[model samples]
Target chain A: MSKTVLSTRGLRKTYGKRDSKFDALRGIAIDIHQGESVAIIGKSGSGKSTLMHLLALLDKPSRGEITLHNHPTANLKARQLNTIRNKEFGFVFQSFFMNSNDTVLNNVILPLKIAGVGYRERRRRAISALKTVGLDDKRNNKANDLSGGQKQRVCIARAIVNDPKIIFADEPTGNLDSATGEKIIDLLFRLNQEKGITLIIVTHDHELAAKCSRQINIKDGRIVADSANETLEAENDDKEEFKDNDMDDMLDHQHPTHHINVDEEEE
Target chain B: MRMLDVIYDANANLLRNKLRSFLTILAIFIGSFSIISTSAIQAGVNDFIDSQVDSYGGEGYLAVVSNDSFDALDGLQNGMGNNKTPIEYNPDKIQTGMSPLTNEQIEKIKKIDGIDGDSLAKEQTLDITYVTSEETDKKYLIAAEALPPGNVKVSLVTGKQLNLQADEYQILLEEKYVNALGYDNDNIIDKKVQLAVKDDYTHKIKTFAAKVVGVIAPSVVSMGYQYTNNKLADDIYQENIKYYPEDMKNKTYAVAVNYDYENYSADEIKDKLEEIGLSAMTVEDIIGTIKSFFDIILTVFRIFGYIALLAAAIGIINTLFMAVQERTREIGLDKALGMSSKRVFLSFSLEAIMLGFWGSVFGIILSVIIGNIANAVFHAPGGFLESFPTFHLVVYTMSDIISVTILIIIIAFLAGTLPARRAARKNPIDALRYE
Candidate 1:
């Protein structure tokens, strides 16, 4: 009976036109309930990341409707959408995007600043958030000076500084070693369990997906598995789901050959 | 966020790239420095010119010169006013008319509109001699001005301005002439002096006793000439030309037209006279011409400053554009955190303004210091332009400094716009996707 905090109906996203048209997301219909932990499992070229981006209001959907908190977001102004993003949602990226020039505390205060929080109040809250991530001692350290594990922790601190109801993490531990990756995952799971915040992760690890309450497997812009009713052990034992989430299962890769380098967006 | 926070953030951004920001500011400093220095030079030069003009007796009085014909009389009139004019001296050229202004011509000028008084002008005569108070020994034989000395600017050293129109025979001795005539520093008021006149045109020799009213100070016009009213002059004129009725107006040399100044613009009067093939100009007009020439020089120097500013503006644009490129991910992160495009744009623009503000302030401050140093070195102190010497070689008025600062800031804004717009319009999703 829990209300859906965010949902998409027949969503589609395409790039380019004519002979070069490429579909990144195709007809995805899903509902995300409040306080739910969901993992979007996919191969490298699956549309899971694009779908996550659309759900987080960071990108416009090409078709169908995105309902956010019972409101249709199709006609929302960018400012209104930004307000929703600032107030209700947080994002954690695989690369740990942060202002390397800024101090650890200042990096964590970004969300509060965007929300127009006062200086002293935001600083206090940023300190508290850093403490939550066990990084209070490194508050004065420059972001670039921090270890990869610490940087991810700072990103986590920033993601939770505003006490957002939902945190959308795209491959949050993709760049980390297994031990540091497990720590980050444990921290995310703790935030979900203790704070009752919804967690939607775009990832390819079956073990990571098994930890979530629901697992949605995608391939080539279409859903191949929905594990809402499946048990955790059943998901772990499923050979087909394991193969579907494999990095090498992308023979009909929807992404371009050069798409592996996300850094090209700089030019 | 609060506006202060946004501004604070912009300041922090500048600090992050200290060397780049400093280099950008140097451009603005160069521009504003040139502006201040050029203005100071103009101020100093104009001050010197003003004082010289004052000493010339150029205030309110117009110069009438002969143009090119046989007008030796206007030429003579101009020759007398040479000491007062701000115009560069060219003794060979006469500007008005070459023909001697006859009595008829004088009468014709008096009829023109705005001629305000009965004593329009006085024609000077060279045929005169100043003797001692005894009226016996010829003391100083000088080109004496015989007529009511109307419209001539004078300052009294010890006494008041002499009443040139009084019926009594009164004279104001020139201060230099007082020493030459063997008088001490004692006040010359009420002292009786003798004038001997020998008019060649009228064929008469006369001597008259006149009361010396006051001693005149050195004037911009001249310190050599002695002054006397027409009371004694009229008596001498009547005695000499009583029987020579052959149109005795031939000796008329110059005419001074007095008009109520408020009734017509100075240009109107000058233009009106030019229509009749004559030239008329006030001391103010000559000063204006000189100031305008200085203004042209100042403007050229200012253009050099503008070039420096232009270079600075380009530097700002280039810096901000690079910042936009370098901070791509940061900008995306900011946008993702709910920064409105307008706020993003404002922050970038504010950053540019801060750069401009710092540069202009430093430039102005440096220029003022340099100007003061130059003033100390180059000021022809005490009496630069005697009438109105600009006190220093350079002047930094509050208004000038403020205006230049504002101008630099505006230019910085113009330079910042393109980069600001680019940052503001960036797509968060794509920007976040940037590595």
Candidate 2:
């Protein structure tokens, strides 16, 4: 049984006053388990991005509690939160938010450098991350010199360079063409499958949302729906059953060893 | 990752604005240069005066004259004064109202434990002649003094000094007179010269012949107002004479004494002379007059230097303020990266100090060149305030340079601090958004 990676309860955010107030997020409750790939789907101004920002520790909720990897976040100082963001979580944005002045390699290495990783090790990990995104050849190119798809790939490389446990991507491929967007989604899925990293993405693309194992919908600062994808529901259940069977087999093999240890101690 | 790294990064950011940094540094240099050059020149002058005074035999000598001598002689001629006798031209005439000290009186003074030897002399104006060549003769009687050989010290550069006990006719010439005579040592020494001394009572020119025994360099004592009163007369006389035993003893006028310890100070010597019934003046009085003149000139130079330095400081302040405004966003970025306000302030202040340090270096180099050129052109004797060619105005001692460097750096730090603090205390969000 994997632990829950993130949990938020009674989160509320309001802008302005009572009469002229706008509630960006209203009492949103959510839980995300480790290794889960989830998408948050909503229309423009649907509060999905605000929820993602709060979860990413980029913004503070007006009234709520948030816990990441079982660590309470409400009382953490700004520096401490920045440390957590550098160490435990990675972020990708719709605009690809790459530092225009830095080369692609430097951009990728920034998160690890911020985490105080030694230079050589940071470079190695950055190169590996760039290879994973299929942009290893573009390492020396400036981020601003890259096309929309290539820029998003560089952003992905930066996000995963520190090997964070979770990646929060907001409209990760929204600025790319449809084909390039699909390719980015496939690459993200591959990384999640192979590395067991949790992926929390917010997007308006229904096709991208349909591909995820779990989908959450938000509207008017409230969660409208949360359910497993109909197409992947049966396959997910089968994989869960197979994981349970493998655990049983391993436990059965260790039973005789446990009994032997007990007899030896008694003697 | 480290504090040094943070500073280095900030320095790189500052390097982007090279012109501003250069201008700031120039301002600091000018300020430091002004202070250092002024102090150096003052030190040089003081050193020169100290040397000159020491050579004139430690400050115990004093000049004494009658109290009425300070009054103009016109009052005595009007018959409206206390004593209605015509003022005699004899040196002894000024000796009235003054304590008369004989050889016995000086012996008593010498026995007073702290008292040293004293020299007494009398002076009179006379006409004299010297032959520069067999055919060319120059005549102009000069003011000449009769001094005791043992008591008076002469620095003779050429020829033999006069023998005190010998009944021979000999005269010593000042180096200036030697030059004026246009006769070198070979020609002047053993040369015969006649002096025409005017007898005050007889009102007749009494001619006496003497041999040039020694030529002395002009000492500060010998150049005092009492000795060479007339520049033209000095050239005409061309010498000082030693009277023989058969001649009448020269009437005494001024007495100069050198105290050993109890009253070796200039002021103490003057007081002692006054107590002994003679009004005395110290060498400091003459030096003081000279110093006041030097002070006026130095003050003018200092005023000009300060004006330039003030303009430079204003330039520094303006440049620093502009830097703060331009780097508002960068400062916010550093804060966002978790740098403390103090660290930010330190970076800017250090930059300002560097500016001052470099500016001072440049200004000092410039001042040295200029001071040297001035020294070469001006040929005045070095005193407590006057710098001459042989003496440098800007003495670049290790301690002096180090002190000036530290002072400039400190000043730069202060100048930069206001802008630095303002930048550091600014709201991070506002700074970040500042265009």
Candidate 3:
């Protein structure tokens, strides 16, 4: 019953021309609610990554439409999309793309820096994010010198530095050993439960999928199963579920009541 | 992203590959060094020539001679004319030396429409047998001539100009003469000097006392010749020609005059003189060849500098292209994190500009150091430029330095556009996938 944060209807993505044509995402439809930890589960080449890219607004869909907070993104300017990405959403990549030569603090400050935040404020926020990942002591360490697990932790710190409403983590722990991967998962779930931040994770590991509040299975670019289908159907019975007040609250940059509203919705 | 951040990152990125950036900047340094050095040399040469022009009877001043005299001199230069073999000697045309301007022709010249008649002064060749200052007993052999009329600006070391019409005899001593005459430039002013003219027939010498008005700086136009005012020149000329026959006494070889230069060009005045069977040569005509010679050499050197700059521009393009390729993944990550395509392009372009800035700054520093050293070396004792105290071998003007830096920066930006565009147009997904 939480407010929908991201929604798509019959989304599709294609690559190349007719002669060498290929469909990366044939069709995908889903509604992601605020504060809900959802996992997109699929094997290799199953288009789960493409679906995440579309939802993250990193790429344009070849067909259908996507809406953020009930507002279609088809007419959004590139500058607006960049602002939304920089201020409203965070990302954690599988390989941990970082400026390896830079300090850990600088790497974590990337999103806020992109948002043109002031030097002092961005630095303070970055330090706080590093503390969340328990790497505050290693802020000055070069990213390249960190261990794989530590690098992943630094990347998570970078992802949450901008205080995004949602964090889209693509295989957040794929490169880590089980022992370290377990710690990373626990940290992500802690952020979800404590901050009530919506989490959309793309992964193929069944164990990781099972930990999420709901799992959506994908095969050949199509959704094969969804654990929250019944809830979606029940919400479909009320067409006006996305109220104007909810849209206004979601659009506000300083929306501070999401956790309280999500807790009430959960109860 | 903020422009300041973009600029800072550009410099930081360049530091990531230090060797590559240094080598690229070195190439640009060569181009900028050569260009600025050539500009300095050109400026120095031009300054020297301008000073020389001012000394040689400045604008509107002309040296007038008879057409026959000019033709005779021209024939001598052209190997005594087209007649390969002597055929017949024509008595009417046979001339022993320069043909003197007739008294009738001189009167016509003074009456010319644009010519300033009051500025006309007969060129008196004063044959001073010897000159001796009151402080020195040694008499040095000397050649003195009357100062030409019309805007004659003689560059002086220390003293005043000659009073052309003053009844008392006055002379301007050359810099070399000041010390030889036992007097320095500052103390030589208004000092008495003795000029002796020998009468060839009787072997009798008459000494005339003249006051030194100024000491002349060493100049190409003057060439060690002492300048005397009209009174001193006429007295010496009359004393030397005291033994000459009556008919040859008044013969004038040349006369200097000033025309209306603001209203009429030199060529226009020359044409007017030509109609009256007279020939005139302006300051430009006398010193133009030397200027053209220097201009040709400097122009060739300037062309070489530009060619080097073109090669350096290519180096910038190549360096940026390689950087773009190497930072593909970084670019993708930045783009995925919502850095705009424009910001990415700006960052790379700023890198190229930074390279140019550093390269040109280094070039200017090194060139200025070397230029000053060369100037000092050339001016030291035993050097060829030792006599020219005022001439600098290389002159660096602020305008030239600024213009060169700006031009190089623009070129660097243009060269960077190729690689920056490629980086900006890259798809985040493909760039991230690129190994």
Candidate 4:
């Protein structure tokens, strides 16, 4: 019953000339509802990363339309896109594109800073986000000084620092070993389950796609399959149950006997 | 981020390239130093000239002379009289063809609207003697001027001034003359000395005795015994009463007129004197000849200072260019981070201005230190840097300092603009990709 959080129709990105042109994204259409963990899987140059960039507003689509939280992004100015990027969406890159000179805490707080959040409030939110990723103790470590797994965790922490509506992660664990990559995947799922944030991840690993509630497989810049996994669906139901219980408890504490009477009078 | 953060970042970045920054600053410093030091020296020189001029009476005074021949009654003619007779003159009667200016001429000049005061004086070349114990006689030809005791151009070390109204019984001696006589006595105000006067008609050398009532020291002693002997003397003597005659009044010459500009200019005064059949000149004419000599010397010094400044400007340009090259990456990063082209330009220009300001400050301090050291070594006085033996070190006034500061800033800003614009126009993508 919740609103659809993201939708795209005939999205296309073409690079180069007509004679030797390349389609990074060719007529992609998808809709993501609230609180969904969707994984996009493809081989190298399959346009998974291009689609992620379009979804994140980091790049403009050469053709077609994208609507996020019901706001059309196709005709948005660069500054408006930047504001949307800052306020509505967060990104985690596989290369861990954090400023090398900044510490883990500073990197995590950067999005908030660009959003013009107050310093103390930014620090508090960044620390909370780092705690969610279990990297609170490593806040002072430089991005380059951390191991592959820790750097990815820092990136995850930075993505969730602003409590954005959606997180678009590109090859989130492509560089890490199996064990570290698994830990990163678990962290992403935990943020999704606990915060109810919409998670859209691009990955090459089929196992990672199977772990999400929905999987969209791309081949040559075109989505070939969109399927829901039974196990992921069951886990999502359990998460919905916990959320409903928490909401009931919150309503009880804040507004008991929540019933409204409508008064209708003829004038 | 706060502006302070931006400034601090800039300062830190500049500090990382210490040697380059220092060189840039030095260039600015040298340029400002040249300008300030030269101005200070010029100011000191002007002050010296003004003092010298004031000491030689005042700026408004003019000394007038006559072009016509002299006659007997002409010499004694007081300008206050109404006798407008133009005497037919003989050139031979005129002493050296420089016809003596009469008291009448002085009074006539004084009657002019602008004329404030005037003095008529007569100078004669005569042999004077002092009898040491009546046997040892010291003989010297002295140029003696008969001025009103108050009108003498020399200061007296001792003794009373000669009474000009008292015929020739009194005389004022030069300080050197008194010292040379070895009079040894402290009070020689009433001492008698003899002066030889050649009679105009008889052509006989008559010795006349007069009392030494005063002593005088000329500011400049030319054609005096001191000029030859390099020793001071008291030689000025009053004429004796016995030899003084009515006919000798034709010897009068030299009139100095003091005037104010409220009524007439120097040219007007000169013209008025010419109307009365006398020639005249102004003090400015004499000063102009003297200043022309000094102008050449100052011009040479100023040219040298200017050359030094040109070299410093070249150094500044070089430093700024180097800085632009070094900060290319940083400029690109700023542009990528949403910095406007104008802001980037302002930042770079501000950095240049800061460099210039610091350079000028350091250069001025260095110049002052060096000037003072030179002054201490050479006993220089009264200039900003005090480098001369008689002038102090050249100190800049507040206005001078402000002007130099603004000039350095302007130069720095101008120097930075070209490089900044070049950096700003760079494509953001290309700049970000630069290693």
Candidate 5:
């Protein structure tokens, strides 16, 4: 078994004071192993989004602890939390929050820029990330000029540009039609399988969750069910078929040689 | 995040709102402009004061006179000394007055080590009339006055300065007299002039022949008065007042003292002269009061500039506050992307600082152009601005320019602190949820 990359124990979150007190997340526990694509499924306000935010270190949990690769992260200062976010985690939002004024290339390069990466390397990696999303041809176009699917593609490029070890996607395809949603979901899975990067997604779509290796159902911030899908079961039996030719063109950022396969994929 | 990235992002964001940025910069521009112009005016006033003092042959010496008789020196002059006006002094009245400086007083003044020299301020009555070369008929009476030579700045037309200790009878013609006395051309310096005074001891009119040694140019503070050393003064004083009534005999001299200004400050010398039961006057005594008055004006004028600067600072705060409110989501996005709150704070503050810096630069450039134009308008030969107290109406000092720039930047940085901190401390979840 691959080693566990992240886990939470008795995680709880609350808002407001005294009489106005309200709980956003109830005590719950879970372990997520590396290279596993997991889906957190829940209804709106079921605390899935809150859990995602806490796991991403975007917000502090009121109680309990979070450990990434066995390193406790519950009490890390804001600066250190930000460092972890920059170097280890990538997030794709539901709304595709791309800076409209920036070029698609610039939008992708932002995370690396924030990481204090050199300009030349950041630009090269940003271009490579854009190619991963199959939007390298539109790199110079303004972000807003792209269609919704294309904009989401730019957002995905931005997320993976820094080579984060874990990609936390919150409803990454909520705004897309089924066909576009599948294409985006397929792209995310390709990254997970090819790079051995961890993937945890929060979504309401059952079809999307059925494709993940594991599905954890949540209600009132508590896990109601946990199970592996048939695809994972079939893979364990060595009977799964991997016929996706695009995966051959998947970006190997550590070695730019794989980046050369992109042009042939367009044909 | 690196500092360069923060600034680059800030610049890119500000560029997205071109009009708002321009308007904010304009507010600071007005603030800096007012300060620079006000400082320039004060600098011009300072130059005016120096030239005014210099016109009186500088502020190095003091005048010591008996009683309040020297009051005429202050009340008699107004405006700059662009023209020479005759002095209304009667030597005999002062010489024969009850409180004239006796020999014993002169000896005591000499005893003061700081006192370089002392002379009797005397005026002489002599009939020296000449017809103008143009008219060749109508004679102009030339009134002659004498003083001890130490402080007066005399510009000669042809000949040289008079020897204050010389026994030779000599006269220095005022520039206006060169033409009024009928001597055309500038060749009157060595010309001979005739004058006759009544002899008090002999009670007979004694006529003496004197040579013109020098001619004084028109002065800015004093004019139209002929100058002669104490040697000639003694001759006229004894011949004119030696036979006056016994009580009037003591008034033949009004004692004046010239000292080293470097060794003694004006107030120190004034106090010393007053201690000897005498009144003293210097150029500074007159101009020092004027300087204080102008200083008050300068302070009051700068208050308006500071108010404008305060308003500009508020403008910066208002601009940044609105920016924080508008960019709530962007700020959240930045934090989510791994930008630390401190970096956020620094980025926003730097944007404001850059705004102020650009505003000050624009203000300085525009105001310098405007100031130079104003100066040109005032300092031109026929310009009416020159008619005002300052010949060159505006002046800029390095300190004034630098201080105004730095002060505005500081004010802007301080103004940005509130909004920057707010941006830094924003909750990422709420900010992201913001529309």
Candidate 6:
């Protein structure tokens, strides 16, 4: 019922040429509403990352169009796209990409600095962002000295420093243990619920996907199931191709117990 | 990104890899130091030359000689240095020393346009036997010549210039003669000195007492020659030529003539003289060879500086390329955060410029300090330049300093473009994915 914040139609992306030609995304049409926490679930190389990149405007689709607030983004210049990304979207990565030698406060100030915000004003906002993540006391500490979870929390602080309208998290908790991952997930969902900001997460963790208000399951390059619709049972007739065999194999290699639980719940 | 932020980041990045940046800057500094030092030395030489010219009564005056006499001097030089083959002797051409200018040629020179007829004075070869002062019995061999007519303000150690038209004999003593004649620069002024001339035939030495008008500072232009008033020079020359035959008595080797320098250039006047079987050398023509000699040596040094700068430019390129490689991930993060490609290029270019700026600034500062110390060392007592008090060993002009700095900065910027372009062209995705 909520107004759509971002929508895509017939979005496709291709890599390489001629002999090495490959398609990462094919015919993906989705509408993400304001304040909705949507999960894009798939295995590695399933075009889930490509879809998030296209939606985040970090990349352009090879074919089709993406609309942000009903305004088509295909015709926007590079400078305009950069501004939109700086002002309207935040990003959290699994690896915690940060200037490790820099102070935590400076790391958090990156986005605002790139936005050309005034020095004093940027410092104030960065400190506030750090406080929100409860790392203000460690603001002067070198980012490299922080533990993995603290480092990820600082990366989150950097992402939200500009107060973007949407947060695109790519495996945001992939590097953290379950307890720390839970804390990060709670923080992301709390921001989504309280600020009415859209949350678009790309992950294959079903437990994380189950918590989202909507889930779009992608296999290979096509959307196979949408939990928002009553297509689970109807789409199950295509179950010969939609079996959990591949997903369970990958999960089993990484998390043996999780693989057993996944099989038990599905059966 | 803002300009301030770009510059700030550039300087901070330079600090991140201190040793690499310092080594690159050191290379630039070597180039800058050599270039600026050479420039300073050239400036100092030129300054000293200008002072010498000013002291020589400045412009208008020319040392005029017969064409045959000029040719003879040239032949003597070439004969001593390069012309080894025996020559067929031609009686018409004067082949050694100088040929006397005929009276007919003198009359023609006076009639030439732009030649001030009244300023012509025969260059008399006064053969003085010796010189002595009333205060000391010791006689010193000396060379004294008639001071050229003009507003001649010689760089004097003490006292005033000689009165050209004074009936009483007056002599301006050289600095060496001042102390040798038992009188210092201060008390020697207005004191009497005696010049003795030996007759050509009888070999009789006649002493002429003259008052000391001033003590002249040693200078390259003067060449250690003393100057005397017209009266003293004429009396001395008359005594020396007393025994000569009629034909030889009137023969003149050269003449000092002043031309209307304001209305006509020196070359124009020289051309007029050349038409009348005469050759003339202006004060500039005499001093120009010295300047060209310095210019040649300094130009070689400047070229070496530029070659070093060329090497330093390569060093800058190497340094920045390494920096770009190391900062690939950081650059990706910045690009992803919305810093434009142009700004990224600008930051790297600014780092090169900053390196050049600091290198040149330090070069200038150190050069100035060392230059001053050298100047002091050269002018101290017993130093080579002690006799020439007005000369400085090095001089720094504002324009030279500014131009050198600008030149190095431009080189640094051009050097930077390669790496900056590389940094700019990096894709955020690929750069981020780089391990």
Q: In candidate 6, list every pair of residues with a backbone clash.
A: none
Per-residue CA lDDT of model 1 for A147-249, tens digit only, reads: 8999999999999999999999999989998899999999999999999889999998777788999889887877677876332223223343344335323
Candidates sorted by TM-score, best first? 6, 3, 1, 5, 2, 4
**What does the lDDT read for residue A20 in candidate 6?**
100
Per-residue lDDT tens digits for candidate 1, residues B1-435, read 679889899999999889999999988889988987887777666655555455444444555433344344554565776557544545775545545654554565566676544646645444564456652344776555553334554445665555666888877777655666656448467777777665556556677777877676554344366666677666655555556556654455455555556777767766666656556656656467767887898999999999999999999999999999988888898888889999899999999999999999999899888887766655445543332223466777787888888999999999999999999999888898887
lDDT of 4 at B288: 61
lDDT, candidate 4, at B161: 50
lDDT of 4 by residue, A1-267 (tens): 577898776566777764697878766667788999999998889998788877876556666667888777766765666566666776776767666555899878767755657778999999999998888998998777999999999988888887888888878888999999999999999888988989999998887888999898877877777784222222212233354335534543432113110111121
Compare the candidates by TM-score and give the number of the best one: 6
Q: Model 2: clashing residue pairs? A: B29-B359, B29-B360, B127-B141, B128-B141
lDDT of 3 by residue, A23-135 (tens): 78755668899999999999989999999999999998766577898888877888888888887888898899999999999999998888889899999999999999999
Give residue B57's error in model 6 in angstroms. Answer: 2.8
lDDT of each: 0.75, 0.64, 0.85, 0.63, 0.74, 0.85
lDDT of 5 by residue, B211-324 (tens): 678776443333355766556656766667767786775553455566677787777866776677566677666566766777788787678778877888888888889899
lDDT string for model 2 (A1-267, tens) is 578899776566666764797878765667788898899999988889888878877667665577888777877876687667777787777766555666899878767655557778888999999999999999999888988989888888888887888888889888999999998899888878998889999998989898887898888877778884233222212233354335434544452223221111110
TM-score of chain B for predicted candidate 5: 0.67
Error of 5 at A119 (Å): 3.1
> TM-scores of the first chain across all predictions?
0.85, 0.82, 0.86, 0.82, 0.84, 0.85
Residue A216 CA displacement from its true place in model 1, Å: 1.8
RMSD of each: 9.2, 13.2, 7.3, 14.3, 12.0, 8.0
Superior candidate under lDDT, 4 versus 6: 6
| Model 5: reference contacts kept, as a fraction | 0.70
The whole-model C-alpha lDDT of candidate 1 against the native structure comes to: 0.75
lDDT of 3: 0.85
lDDT value, residue B12 of candidate 3: 93
Superposed Cα deviation of residue B9, candidate 5 (Å): 3.7
